[model samples]
Structure formats: C-alpha cells, structure tokens
Target: MAGANYTLEFGLEAATDDATIIARTVQEVDAALERVIAAASTFNHNPTAFVVERPRFGPLQFPDHGLKIDVDPRLGVAALAWVGPDFDCPWVTKSDRPVPGASLHKDIDSATPFPDDAAITLDQLRAAVHEFRESGGHRPKCVEWQEADGW
Candidate 1:
C-alpha cells in the first residue's frame, strides 16, 4: 500500500520579546517528536525517526521517510512534513480503515481516514505546547497545514 503524507505548520507570538522562549519551545518540540517516534515504532515496520539537523535551527530529518521539521525563528513558525509508507498498525488502520480515537479525530470525519499515530501525536503535542505558551501570555497563531511542495 502507498504511504500517506502529512504536514503541520504553526506559529506563536509572545507577549514580550523573549528570545529564550524560542529555544525553550524548540526543546519542547524535540521532546514531543521523540515521544511520537517511539509510539510510531510500535506499529510501523519502518518507524519514523527523529534527527535534529541543527540545535535550535532545524531541518529535523526522519531518514528514509522523507520527514522533516523546518523551523523559522524569525517567523516564529515551525513546519513538519512527512511522506512514507502508510501505517498499517491495527490501532491506526484496520483492514485499511481508520479506528476512532481521542480528540485527534476531531478534525477528521467519518469519511476521512484516520491519520497515523505520528501525525496525531505531533498535533497533540503542538496544541499542548501552544496552550502552555498561551497561558504564559504568549499568543498562538497561524496554525495551518502546508503542502509538501510549498514547504
């Protein structure tokens, strides 16, 4: 079966000119990516991997899977993109159908196939971090998906 492709892009605006938050947020994102990769490995034969190309400046790679995280501190934005074999795990795809799960399914409808664990996990982590930053008076903004070609 052909693998599915996905991408997630988002930005944040802090109340203050805190350059430190950039590094901190990047660290948090890296940790979250680790967790997602771990979860994906259980189900995917070729589990996605996390590789940081640069400390704070990223072009994080998930080798062989064409996955990468591109972050732009100037724009306060990060874009994650993946293109690889479809996750055939029972939890995610059963008989080529998606199983309903947590809030991750909110954006998906009955007709829409469920996204892989990696995508869900990444989205959740992003949302969580965004919320945390918001609580600290930082504004989460421009959460959107971009085409792989565009990224």
Candidate 2:
C-alpha cells in the first residue's frame, strides 16, 4: 500500500494526566514514546515509513515492546494543495500507484521497513495541515477504493 508522504516537523508530548483511560488505553502509545526517545528524533515526531495508505498500522518496522500505526485513515494519494508556486501537480496520481522509483525511507537510513520516498508535494503538506486543523487530522476516512474494488 503506497501513498503520499507527510512530515509533521514536530512532536506531540506525552499526554500525561491522572486520566487512567488515556494513559492505559493504547499500549502502543507507550512503545511509541519509548522508541521516540531523545530529542533528535523529534520525539519520534519523525516516524519513518509511515505508510499513508492505511489509517492504522501495527508492529512498525522499528518494533520494541508494542507498536501501532495511525495514519489519517484517508484514501487518496498525498497530493499537492497547489496553493503556491512551489506546488507541482503529480504525474502519478492518487488513482495510480507509483511505479517503483526512489525508496521512501531512503532519507532515514535507519532500521525501518517503510520505504520513505513517497511522491508528495508542498501544497499537499499545507493542505494536510489546514485540513488537520479544520478537521482532526487531514483527509476523510474511507477504505480506499482499489481497482479491485471497482475503482
């Protein structure tokens, strides 16, 4: 499942409170925190190989105690928002899977299974941010319509 790429450029601090629900709810959260140890990782703010195609992932490449993947759960290739001059419309689109080219995770150079090099653009980044703000995380949730699904 290949799709668009997104870099948060920051990290969300551990949500610590006496709220037992949030604390003990998701086991992977703790694992995510531990793996994200150290500031250089941007507090795991930089999760390499985050496959955008699915909303939830598991046993991420860099596994430890526990793990899970929570993508936006939206279907659609990460596209350029086309908001500014920096934007470039893609040749391969959300409707088409990218022909193998650069490795998505090529930049990380670490222990991870996700290929990091996704064909994405600045406008898409901007759009994701704006949408994330408007909604809670960018894009609408849907089981992407695969060609096999009659797309």
Candidate 3:
C-alpha cells in the first residue's frame, strides 16, 4: 500500500460532521468503508454513495477520475459506477434500482448517478475497492461496466 494516493468522500452527515474523509492507503480505505456502512446502519436516510477519487492527471473532471460506491449496509449490497471518456460500466442485464440511485452530497460534488441495473454484493464491492486502489483510481475492470447516458 506504499505510495497509494486516493480520496474517499462521504456525504452522510453534511450538517453535523465533516463531509470529506481522505484515505491515502488501502487500509484507510477499508476503514472508511467500514465506517460508512456503520453510519448507514444507524441512520434512517441512506446516504448518497461515497466516492473514491484520485487527483486529475489530465482534463478529467466531475464524473471522471472517480469510482462511486453506494453501499446499502442494511441490504448488504452496493452499486459501483464511474463516468468519463469511454468510461462507463458495460450493460449486464437490468435489475432493480438501488436506493439513492443518483446521490447528491450537499456541499460536495454530486456523484455520477447509477442506472437501474446492477447491485453488487458486499464482497464484490470490497474487491472493486481494492481494484480501484490497485489501479491508482481508474475505474475498476473487476466488474462489468455499463455506459452511462450521454457517454
């Protein structure tokens, strides 16, 4: 996990707590995920999916250079997505939409909304996070991707 560079942004408690938590290593990211799940379980309204991002290396902005993880701890599932140049998850059949499909974090940039199609398991979410960390923040190829609208 040496030299790992990534940012984990949370949107659960904007009015009462810090909105952003930066995780610079794999362990920190794992910890952040754990914290997020715990927070969701205790809160009533599900939070907008949190994001993992790296500093822009080129012209990437907004939906680019980031992987969004919307975890539903109560359901033990999550949605993973990203958007950028040629950067959308490929379609793999449609499924029920996850809660908070399009997450908006107050005071922070809104995460790219996920479509109604895929909801990955917790284990899968962990793997995807690892892949995102390993890839230095590029959208992970570990899971199938569907291109977002206007992509």
Pairwise TM-score winner, candidates 2 and 3 = 3
Q: If ranked by TM-score, best first, what sequence of candidates would result?
A: 3, 2, 1
> What lDDT, from 0 to 1, does candidate 3 have?
0.52
lDDT agreement with native, every candidate: 0.29, 0.25, 0.52
Ranking by lDDT: 3, 1, 2
lDDT at 61 for candidate 1?
Answer: 37
Worst 10 residues of 2 by lDDT: 142-151
Candidate 1, backbone clash total: 1
TM-score per model over all chains: 0.23, 0.27, 0.59
lDDT of 3 at 53: 49
lDDT of 1 by residue, 15-108 (tens): 2211111223545655544444343213211212222221222375323222233222332222333333333211221112222342222112
> Clashes per prediction?
1, 11, 4
* Model 1 spans > 4 angstroms off: 1-66, 87-151
What is the Å distance of residue 141 in model 2 from its true position? 7.6
